[model samples]
Target chain A: MSTSEGTTSSVKVGGLTLEVHRRGAGKPLLLLAGEEQLELDAPFVAELARTHEVIIPSAPGFGHSERPDWITSPDDIAYMYLDLIDVLELRDVVVVGFALGGWIAAELATKTDRSISKLVLVDSYGVKLGSPTDRDILDIWTSRPEKVLAAKWADPAMGKRDFSKMNDDELTIIARNIESFARFCWEPYMHNPKLKQRLHRIKAPTLLIWGEKDGVISTSYGEGFAKLIPGARFAVVPGAAHYPQIEAPEAFLSTLRGFIG
Target chain B: MDAWHFTEMPYPNLPPIDSLSTMRVSLPNKLFDPKIGADLYNRYLDEYMIADDLGLNLLCNEHHQTATCIDVAAPLTAAILARQTSKGRICILGNPIANRGDPLRIAEEMAMIDCISHGRLDVGFVRGVPYEIFAANTNPTTTVERLWEGIDLVVKAWAPCDEPFNFEGRFTQRRAINLWPRPYQTPHPGIWITGSSDLENIKRAAGRGFVFATFLQPHEKVKWMFEGYRSAYRDTGLPGGGGTAYMPLVYTAETEEEAEKGAKELTWYLNAKAEPQYRNPPGYVPVDFNVNALKGTFTGRTDAMRAKTMEFLKEEGVMVYGTPDSVAKQIKRLYDLVGGFDHLLMMQQAGWLDHARTVKSMSLFAKEVYPQIRDLPRTKPLESRAAAE
Candidate 1:
């Protein structure tokens, strides 16, 4: 259970062995990950863990998590997290999610606000904000590698990985994460068709954050997403792209602190 | 030794390769001049007609949003060949059933084509290539499962069911499943399934008594696959002999000089480039395959294949091209190496090999090479052969 950052543990939830990364000790703050796994020792995570009981779990089928055959969509993951909350006995938890994780967080909130006290979605993906013909998000699967990299971070180099040098375990995790991402997002192209209509159902206090330079999904799209959730405030982190928490950690945390505190 | 003539029907005239990042998926369609494409389609169909006249079976394949194959839909071409050609058995290798919307529709279309050809139809179902995951807008993670389910549904639909049965599967649902026009062939025309590296699918295809095919891999790998299929076929104890097929670039000429030139031109099919990211879409291939790819034990086509010389290709048994007698010898060598394969899917035309050269190659292959190797004995059981050895 002990790790370099804090501790790693597995919690049996909804027939899946959920891999949870825990740091700090205070009020529960459930952190959901996005395209890439969170850097457990990142300054932003370290800072947040100082003020909150930071708990991060890899979405089912991502990282070391066991994905049962029945867990096929983000909605299923959301339901599993709901089970995680009851099993861990966490209450008044502040739920924060990034990118794909943000989509799951929003889905979880819409279903029930019983365990959630507040919600923060950072550069999230889960809603259709455009006309049927319009593309609201960049398709990383089909887009040129350079285009996808450039759109993913303010500095494209931040998104680049020397996969050839990566070890087998590292490569396996990356492959599994991508496969899981595709499982949830490929058909709907990164958004749940019904999530747009259900955003109103989220009863918790909400904040939507966008990186000002995020090319994957524009700030206007973020603003439109915020408008869907009643009382949700939209904040923009300057000098960042799709992954503001990685590219502009301090700015992202400050905005998150202002709203959550 | 039934030979099937095939081409990707490529529109090779394009701007320099350096100007484009990829040849597929996101390639701009505006660059495709419809006038030239019109001429190319007619020429390609004309090549198929020539193959038909020469007593070669015709095979058509489909790819989407790529200049490499302008034949966007194989059924359209298969339907055309079914009507236009008299004797040649028509095969579409085949409908991307997993990517397609309705399995019933595919069943209907294949059945219609079978009726038109009067049972000279070999229906092929494919999971499509990794790059096609983008073009088809289908989920890659569940494609293999979807493909198998789709095949099962199609087979059941083609079965002699008097009552309309309901089909309820994970990917597809139907209230009533009664095929209007049953296939012309009894118990349906021959079912063919193709896979490159998936041995499980090869075994499954064999177990079901479907003709299994692997295209353009190194012969050693094909030999391994053939061994796997033979073993699995034995395990299943399927009735009648199982059918196995192989596709290799094939061109034959009257002289060595022309044969070498045609062989080089035909490799244009191998050189069609897609960006590395597009080439390995997540979930399109199994995680083990991707993990192995990252470790550099790549099972898919390697970059070496693109840079391979005609000599190297011939040596690898990926391509069989030479004078008529030489071509026969190369195929016989391949036959021995892979134990044996019943159907030879010949990619006789590709790249800048002009229509004249394609026709010439087909004619030469049919007239000379075909007769020389047409009756190679049916492959004896590998175990029996090993015991004999």
Candidate 2:
């Protein structure tokens, strides 16, 4: 079960087997990776593991996880995570999600009353907050890699990696992750139409973290998402794009620690 | 072999290819001029009518958000053609059922077209090209399964069974699956499936006794696909060569030099209109298929073909264009190369091939080429042929 950086284990959630990476010691913090490339051993996740018991599970059809044929949408994954929580008998769980995972976290929070103690959404995607002509979320699926990277990162240079150096296995995993993400988020387009109305059903204390320079989804979207959830706090991590934790790890962790503490 | 005239119904008047990376999926709508679109639609319809007059089957295809193809709705065009043409079989090659939210709607539309055409309707189903999955916002992972389920639902809906049936598919579900007006043709219209080197699709097409079409691939790849289809049909205990069809980009004129001059538009279509990234978004084709492509085992198409010269394409038999006699000879070579085919869907119009030239090519192909190759021996059941031998 032990990997190079962390110990990985498989947990049966309903009919599917999900791979979870466990590290750190204190209170259980369920870390949900984003739609793009489910990297369990990312530096940000590693940094968070130093303080809390970080349980990062690769969503179905992502990385080494087993995706059941019926698991098509984000709601399915949300329910699966809820089942994962029940199966693990985990209590007072602080659920943190990034991008697509953030949308899933919001869904998971609405479904449960006590299992999740707190919710942290990092540059989340779920709310539609603009005119019909306005593009709320960047169409990353069809865009060029450099354009997507430019939108996703505070500095595109940070995200640029020589893909040619990667072997076939690495490329295959990347492809699978992208495919799985598309499977979950392509239709209804990274947001649920009913999610805005259902935000009132969430029982946990919520924190909306926005990367100030996020080009994928604007800060206004993050603010709107916060406004919908009752008793939710909105915080901005400056000098970062869609993935603040990746671009500005120190600022992101400090903000997270302040909210979780 | 039966001849069918096909076009992507391209909006040829557009900005340079250097200005845009692709013609599909992400192509800006600002580039589309409604006046031009209005002219093109009617002009394309006129071309279809001309093909019908010349005694050729009419073929139309659908693509979403693309200048490469203005036929956004195949059934709509088929419905129009049904009302317009009398004798020619209107073939929609075809509606991308996987992208559609409801398969029953397709069943209803096709049935309506059949009723309008007075039973001369050929239903051609396709998994669609890669970019279409993105354009329609459908999941590629489940496209093949969804396509099968959709076809099954459509077929069941069109069946003559009086009792209402229910369909609970993995991708779609419905209660009381019954279609009104049924279809003009009993047992529904003839089903055809277009594929390019996807063996699973070929098998599905052959197993269901649906016509198998290989479009826009090299001749060697088409030959391999035809062999696969024949083998699959034999395995299913079906007779004949799986009702195989091939659609190649074609242009013909009075002289070889004139034909070659006209064929430049096709070169533009091949090089610029067929952008690789737009044609193949991630997860559109299966990972295994791509891997096989990389290993040189799968010979359908590669990105490198985009850079191919017109002469190279002609040499490769990806295109057939010349004087009437020369074109006829080349088609015969193609027919022999692929063993035999039931139909030949010739794309006489592509890129910016003007209406006049398109008409000329269509007229020439109908008059000269069709007569020569129409009676070529079609592929028969491999098992039976082996027994006779």
DockQ top scorer: 1
lDDT of 1 by residue, B1-389 (tens): 89999999998998887788778877888899989999999999988988999999999999999989999989999999998899999988988999996999999999999998888999999999888888888888988989999999998999898689998888999987889899998888888889877888988988888888889888998998888788777777674346889999998998889899898898888888888777878788888787887677774584658877778889989999999999999999999898898999999988899988889999999999999888987654456435322
Residues A1-261 of candidate 2: C-alpha lDDT, one tens digit per residue: 123476888888897889888888889999888876433646777777778898888889877788787787888899999899999888999999999889999989888888988999999898787777778999776667677888988899888765566566655566677778777887777888888888999989899999999989989889988999999999999999998888888899899989897
Q: Please, what are the lDDT tens digits per residue for candidate 2 over residues B178-285?
A: 788799998789999988757878876887888998776778888888877787787787632249898777998999999998887876556545444455555677
What TM-score do all the candidates reach, one by one? 0.96, 0.92
Record all residue pairs in model 2 with backbone atoms less than 3 Å apart, i.e. clashing.
B1-B374
lDDT at residue B296 of model 1 (Cα atoms):
75
The clash count for each model shown is 0, 1
Off by over 4 Å in 2: A1-3, A37-39, B26-35, B239-241, B274-277, B289-303, B384-389
Q: What is the C-alpha RMSD of each candidate to the true structure, in Å?
A: 2.2, 3.2
Best by TM-score: 1
Cα-lDDT of candidate 1: 0.87
Off by over 4 Å in 1: A1-3, A162-166, B295-299, B384-389
